[model samples]
Target: MSNIVSVFAQKCADYDEKNVQSAIDSLFAQMGGVAAVVPQNAKVFVKVNLVREMSPEKCGTTHPEVAVAVCKRLLTVTPNVTVGDSCAGMYNKGMLASVYAKCGMTAIEDRTAARLNQNFETGVADVNGKVLGKCEFTSAFLDADVVVNVTKLKTHSFTGYSGAVKNLFGLIPGMVKVEMHSRFPDLTAFCDLLCDVCEFARPKTVLNVIDAVWGMEGDGPTNGKPKFIGHLLASADPYALDAVAVSLFGDPRSMPVLQAAMKRGLLQDDLANIRFDFERWKAKRIDNFDAPPIDHTDFFGNQLAWINRLAKKHMVKRVHPDKTCRGCGKCAMHCPAKAITLVKRKAKVDQRKCIHCYCCQELCPFDAVRFRTSLLYKLARRFSGKRSKNT
Candidate 1:
């Protein structure tokens, strides 16, 4: 615990294959070489944020070039490297085939020696988590000797920021994620659970690499605008990686997931104790970066009849599908609250039953679903802004 946390970061302007590979090799060499983490003959699982079946251009998942770069480096260590992720979709052969093909992961297998893991079996592991005792994890994730967690930097509607820790949530398959969300709906609880899962998976994760070459803002992990971050980050500690990645956007303290981890004494309060080797990368940092906007409707402290009614009418943020919806029923299928119904072709969310989890926005392949804030909510944010400044 006394040892300093090491986080390495460098700007990667684009997903140029040779450029990314060289950067990885250079970062590893600077950090005491690749042997510092992966050993020869190790069975390495290159875990990418294949959160959904999307092209790398969407900036939704890890770039194929980045995955291939890590796989190639692992190849220098061992031949048993496999790349995989269990995103928010059916984990069948047909689905996995399409996801891999669409996400440019097939290119990783084609161009490199790494195999595409299509394993759909599930297994339970004891995380010794603070929130829950154990969790259901994909066997491919649990069985691997080493898991190189390759993640994308993005903003999540649920978690304040989607970085290294939130990326590990993909380790749990699509459906289990829905169940877990149902169990822990509060932001602090959900974030605590996220920390539990990350801590559980940390032992097997030899390295955590974030693909910030191009990142996402606004509503993300599924729908958002792609912004060029021009950076690649690597670290032995996932917590440290997240700490550094979120800093580039703004104050990490404003982020709830990061705060939850720190509150649990899982991470350092500040990065002063951590060591970085980026060498003036801050000169390229985005000063006007657009972080995902937050709605503080988490205050349901009273259940009075009139109070509940008022909250029902004004406090809740509504999800509405616009004209862009292709009516694929992904929202209806994945809705944990069973609040969504496909009327004709468009997905209709029953406001009475909706939990405002924002799962629809997170998983919708098309950028169809978005938030509709109420009048009173806007007024509340205005007053809260001044209150925050005064405090």
Candidate 2:
């Protein structure tokens, strides 16, 4: 296999615009530039992770500055660049447009005369052979000749770390995300399904760029603290890019998505072959990034071979909520699964059906629904904690 990764870290120079752009230009030029990856006549689709309505300043979404810079550079090769994303909740094309405008991308469009598109088409990837059913995706992603994935580096509660691979999961449009969560209720199973989707969607993506200038710590993808890393990463291999990213800020062992990718042999666990100059772009390493407490050995450790089968049989039921859910469901829609329903201008869930997917908790705008488990589960958590301490 070809050594497909290169990293450049020039601390003092990176702060200089001439130096930074030159570095970026050199990297892209080495990787065959936009022309090599994106054909001159091809329609280039820039897929960004605009998961929530948070402004670029929040670090919940990809920074506009990064997107604009890349777009400006790409325009040197091609003008058919379209920036789009399937945002969560309501489709606010204007909101995204505003972000791009703030990031100076809109000026590039005005100056260079390009087009910006939003997610429109509905597509699906079959995951029938895996732990979950087929996942529905936006059509814009499926039809593009050149797909560039731009993701922000952040911590995720469920998957451990959110980077390029996890960002693509947002391609699943609208309420379909909730349905997929319901299918793979557990973390390991869900991560497997995510990797399956990545494998299926691999051909559609040509390049991956991670915005590491400023990232989120603690709870993220949303609801996390912002940590500035002052780094930007790019690669043809999403797995390698993510591997490097996780190493910079978080533990590899704790990331379900990374672990799952390793288990499937989709990525190399060792970073020895990857080529990057750490001295130029390396940020002051952050410590004590918080993530969910999960012992993979206890969860899927022993029967790694049988996780797919075991998940299908014993995976806990989880609850999911859509943007429309205001945490209020009419009495007629009130559900005990803690699966949210609208009742009398209020939203509630059927706690009985909740599988602990934390979907409702994640998507709830009002933060109404939360994980509510039995006392036994709580005690189990305490015992597991004490055991870890003693060990």
Candidate 3:
């Protein structure tokens, strides 16, 4: 395979409304220029990561300035550019329209007259004979001559981190994401499935732009601490883009998603092959940021045969919301196990049926689901921690 991954980074000290546009424009120019990838007059679909309904200050979704800059650039090539993402559980186009309005992209629809194609359909993706059934997708995605994947860099509770690859997962539509999660319950398996989804939609994603100007750390994608990285990254390879993102945090190899991607041969693990324009950008470490701990042996340990016999398999439980949830039904809609139900406008979990796949927590629009560890599990972890220190 050709060494197809190219990354260009640009440092912009401010994310304020005044400088955001110029920064994006400069980013576009430095990253091989968008014109080279997107042809003039081609039907281009720009997929922005709008995972949840939160203001730009919350850093829960892609910055509208980033999207506006992309649209502005692409419009130079084609007026056929369309921008949209299937929001989690809610399909209120007006809410998304409002986000665009706040970010100065209202002109995409109103002024520049860019097409807003929102109707998506269910499709199937086959991964190494394992078929992911009933995936909801926008027809514009499949029909587009080129796709620009714009994503935010953030840490995730389940998949380790969310970047260019995880952003596309939103395209699968609301509840269908839950079903996929149920099918591939393990993190490694789920990431493999994500790669398959990318392969199937490879033709669509011709370019990737990651908004790292401001990102989330420590249990994010949403509901995490925001860190200002003051950088913009662009690449043609999603894997390469994600690989670079993991390095920015500290240890890329330690990340489960990157480790899984490396094992599957989906990306180059060698950082040597990957080039970085450090002159334009610099790495900033996140202080006091601890990646959520996982039971390596339980999740990836080979002693499963022994543990299964000794400890009863803990059935997955729906993380209880410490506070009253907004009753958005996003969890119910995206529960892959279908274990969550709405009771009097509140979400109720049937622990017996929950597989602990964590789709509910990841897809919760309200960030209400907090992982609850039982007393016994806590004791076990305590013992495990002591044993590791002694060794």
- lDDT digits (tens) for residues 119-227 of candidate 3: 5554554334234544556566767788889888887767767888888776676556666777787666777777767766666688888888888876576677787
**Model 3, TM vs. native:** 0.84
- The RMSD of every model to the true structure, in order and in angstroms, is 3.2, 5.6, 4.1
Badly placed stretches (over 4 Å) of model 1 are 1-3, 277-282, 295-316, 386-391
Q: Which candidate leads the pack in lDDT?
A: 1
Tell me the tens digit of each residue's lDDT in model 1 across 160-205. 5788888888889888898887788667788889888988888899
Q: Report how far off residue 116 is in candidate 2 (Å).
A: 2.8
* Per-candidate count of clashing residue pairs (backbone under 3 Å): 0, 35, 1
- List pairs with backbone clashes in candidate 3: 178-336
User: Distance from true position, residue 143, model 3, in Å?
Assistant: 1.1
Worst 10 residues of 3 by lDDT: 382-391
**How close to the true structure is residue 375 of candidate 3, measured as C-alpha lDDT?**
57
TM-score of each: 0.92, 0.76, 0.84
Write down the lDDT that model 1 would get.
0.80
Better of 1 and 2 by lDDT: 1
lDDT (Cα, tens digit) per residue for candidate 2, span 91-117: 446655654554444544564445666
lDDT (C-alpha, whole model) for all candidates: 0.80, 0.62, 0.67
